[model samples]
Target chain A: MLYREAGQFKTTYAADMAVFPIRQDRIALALLVAVAFIAVPFMAEAQVWPFRTDYMVRAILIPFLILSLAAVGVNILIGYCGQISLGSGAFMAIGAYSAYKFATGVHIPLAWLGTAISIPPLPGLISIPLGGLMAALVGILFGIPSLRIKGLYLAVATLAAQFFFDWVFIRVKWFVNYNSSGSVSAPDMYLGPIHINTPVERYLLCLSAVVIFATLAKNLVRGNIGRQWMAIRDMDIAAELMGIRPLYAKLSAFAVSSFIVGVAGALFAFMYLGAWEPLAFDINRSFQLLFMVIIGGLGSILGCFLGAAFILILPIMLDQIPHAVGIPVSVETVSHLVFIVTGGLICYLLIVEPRGFARLWGIAKEKLRLWPFPY
Target chain B: MVEFGQFLEILIGGLLSGVLYSLVALGFVLIFKASGVFNFAQGAMVLLAGLALVRSLDFLVARGIPMPVAILMGLMFAGLVMALTAWLIERFVLGPLVNQDGLTLFMSTIGATFILEGAAQMIFGSDVYPLPLFPTDAWFLFESAFPGGILVNKLDVWGGLIAAILVAGLALFFQRTKTGRALRAVADDHAAAQSVGIPISWIWFVVWLVAGLVALVAATVWGTKLGVQFSITFLALKALPVLIIGGFTSVPGAIVGGLIVGAGEKLAEAYLGPQIGGGIEYWFAYVLALAVLLVRPQGLFGERIIERI
Candidate 1:
């Protein structure tokens, strides 16, 4: 009854064009954001809740948020642009290492008359986007092939990028700040008086970063540029005939997509792994992000989070399922089961509905709208 | 100079290893030609083949079966497993997705890859299993003017011969058989073949069977060379650059591409690796393929793609 939009009528074009035109959807979204930002943290502080501070902050929420960010980033490139990239991990690595370098290597000397001013070493806010920018530059460079190649060949080209980046980062010591051992530490991150040192601060930082990037991605995909991308994706020849510049649309998609993915990588390094080497952002990372985009739903924004949550959280839940039921299975066996389940689900979902879990959610809502009587 | 002799040795060894690359690429070409699915599960299929053979052999041997009987039975059992895998793939994956787009089909195969990889690992734990069937004692030494003479493993020579025989047998099977002609017809036009009473489904089944057998042979040979483990799956990826360079559809292309990539990788790693902190073998083939692609996107022997308006 609450979902029936019967009493509401859009008086303006802006109202009709709103993202959540249904009042119930808007309310639900607001409630969700409020719960994520406020209620979760509040519950973490309470002594009674199952939301233990250490487990919630360190294990589940932080990784979930960062991966969701990556899913969004991958979705923008593969989903919106209609370009398939197996090098998203390479872009992520670029973001991470670049951010690491900026955080540690930069020292700005501010001069004002007789006084020498210094802003204490590395700030997380600036370094993250700087990392994104670096990734965007690299992304555009690698994206040069989409101009000449299409489909399966383009995929191989992207794989080339993955292998190339893997080689460059590991072989070139400069990316690692020339540390004797390749893995190096993230610098002390500070935003004025508040030090982002603890798990809660790191979680909050990642949460905010995810929210900002997601909103940015959402708007980018909804706008004119996003239309151009979908046009190229659906049919490049037709898109070009209609006066859409393939070069501009394709490159912009690469840049914007890489920027968000880059930010996610930065957060992944800064918040989650803390001190990650090049190996952390290998080909498997690319596959994980690609699977998220695919399994979530290719063309929906909400699909990103849905896909990320399913892929990231499902294995953990799968392990706990056998334990909770007292099946007495080993961890290795459980892990293997998890893999089989994941693979089986992917095939099943693709066969039934190639659009993914997000489309299934849409169908559920559609069914809810028509629930009282058979159509 | 010793360098020239060493270079010649590297070329020969690379060619030998290139046989493995060709074997793997052959699996891809056979499937892709029949169905446009670009089988990502080829690697997983290879792993399964290795596990299937070893596990079957062990299971039979413990029952007091003679060595030759056990070996023959194990090979037959391995073939049976591949057939079962092919049937499962056809029924569960390709059957349901008859008219789906290439991307969806590709992704589904990737799903199949994960399932097969997990299943194989689950059945036979992730330890490396070596099938020491090939001769390991004899070393062929080129006693040229090199300070350190070039040493060649006898197993590699035998491996090459076996691979050559397999390829020759496949070529003859394709050229001389009616089923092969029907397969080519199906590949040429699925709807056309169907209209003319060719069972497209059976053709697909046969194609997959052949591909699986090819994977089995490749995996067993590779296992003999190195060992059968999760890492053996990576050899399939090594075949990818070979496909890129040779052309995805051409049999001859796969062989030539494998040889070129093998030699290029070994030469690059051997000569220039020390200057670049080593490990050039990992990405060298991919980089080489990418460079070649920029010049000729159709690959060396791949059919030229025609984009229609």
Candidate 2:
């Protein structure tokens, strides 16, 4: 009864068209944001929460945001456009390495720089978008094959892109700046007196970036382009008959998806790892991102975040569970168990709810709305 | 100038290596033909079998058992374990996930891949274990009566011969056996086959078990060549291009595709490595397969499938 929205009514078309049409949902979202912004920092500073480590914040939360963005990007193409991609990691790598190059190769003023940069000028902010644009170009190039193939065949074609990018990254010395270690990294950005090097700072930056991109994505998904994408995803032939250009819609999906993924890649490089090789963006990473999309919810932007959190946070939680229970198991053994359990869970999730965790959340919300009057 | 005999030696060795690649690809084809799922875990299965063989040998030797008895027991144990795995997958994973879309099934397989990899690593330890198939001193020398000589190892020849025999036996089994016919029927159309009285789950289990046995043979050959290592599992990615070039459903296509990829990759490394500052061969096979896919995605022998809108 407390969760019922019986008294709520939308008087305007604008109210109905809003992302969260229900007044309750808008309030809940605001409260969630408030808790994240106000409560989290205070709790973290007070060390009241158990997961207050700097490393966890930087390594886990930052990467979580980045990967969520990438997952959203991939979902647009694979879930909405009906184009299967095995090259999401490649696009991410392109974004990362390109961002690294721009950050290092270009110069930025100290006043505009964040504290992550020791150098006088920092180009990291500019490099993020540049990396995304570069990834988009590559995504479009790889997407050309989609014009001819569909389904599993298209998937294999995308796998070709994964190999091509992996090879290029490994073979070309110029991309990695001829580093003997076969790796490249970006310097931290600085904004005058404030340093973005700390985990808290990086997390904030990633959070803001994710929010911006996710908002833009939400708008985009509701717009004309999203309808065309969904149409193409459901039936390309029908979409073509409806005057939607299949080539344009598919390619644009790839471009936009890659662009977001690229930005995430830049964040991943600049904020996390700090140093990475071609092996870092291997096929395994591609699979991990794909899993994130699959388990989170295909065709839903909110699902990306849910999937990323589930895949990323679960391992850490599992590993720490033994400690919480006072068990003396070694970390290695715990990790192995974590893998098996995670695998089993993934299989379970796929079997039980292939649409992903987001769908479950939707059902829960619906149940909440109709709690008193069971249909 | 180098002698013509030297070129022949490289060619012979490359072709032999190609045969072993075909053995691994064969394991992949069997499951694909029966279940329509691209079993990415095939390489891991091969690795598991190889590790089990080595571990069993260690266990038997520690117990003072005879060498031949140990070998036989190892093969039996490995086969049994794989059969169990097949049963578990069919009953729990595949049965529940049967109605899901293709991508969901694909991701599930990937999850299976990681679980297998992690389990193998944990059980076998992270060290590379060598299983001695034959005496190291065994060699076959082809001496040129003129002056220079070429030497080929007997083990390499054995690898080639064993691969050929296994492939032939598999072909005969599929062509002549009742179970194989059922498998083929299931592959043709799952619903139709089920409606006609074929137990879909049982067929899936049997095919996976067959795949597991094939993996054992592949493991022996590959382990003999490269020694069992974690990197071998990644070599399964090599089969992706092969599956694309050879057609997922064709056994002969897998053999031919494996040969082309194995030989083509080695040839690229040999001829073009120096020109490209080396290592182009590593990914060249996949690139070639991708190019071929652009021309014929149905592959060399795959049947064309048209979907209705």
Q: Each candidate's chain B TM-score?
A: 0.94, 0.92
What is the i-RMS of every prediction?
Answer: 1.7, 2.3
lDDT of each: 0.83, 0.80
Per-candidate TM-score against the hidden true structure: 0.95, 0.92
TM-score top scorer: 1
Query: Highest DockQ, which number?
Result: 1
If you assessed candidate 2 against the hidden native complex, which CAPRI class would it receive? acceptable
Where in model 1 is the C-alpha error above 4 Å?
A106-122, A373-375, B144-148
RMSD of 1: 3.6
Give the worst 10-residue stretch by lDDT in candidate 1 chain B: B136-145
lDDT of 2 at A48: 69
lDDT of 2 at B77: 86
TM-score of chain B of 1: 0.94
Give me the overall lDDT of model 2.
0.80
Question: What is the per-residue lDDT of model 2 for residues B1-309, given as tens digits with 9 covering 90 to 100?
Answer: 245666655666666666777777888789878877778788888877788777878798889999899989988988887898888888888877664556666677777877777787688765688878754344444564413555566666787788778878888888999988999988777778889999999999999899889888888777776788777787677778877788888888887887787777777777678888777766777788778777877789777756533
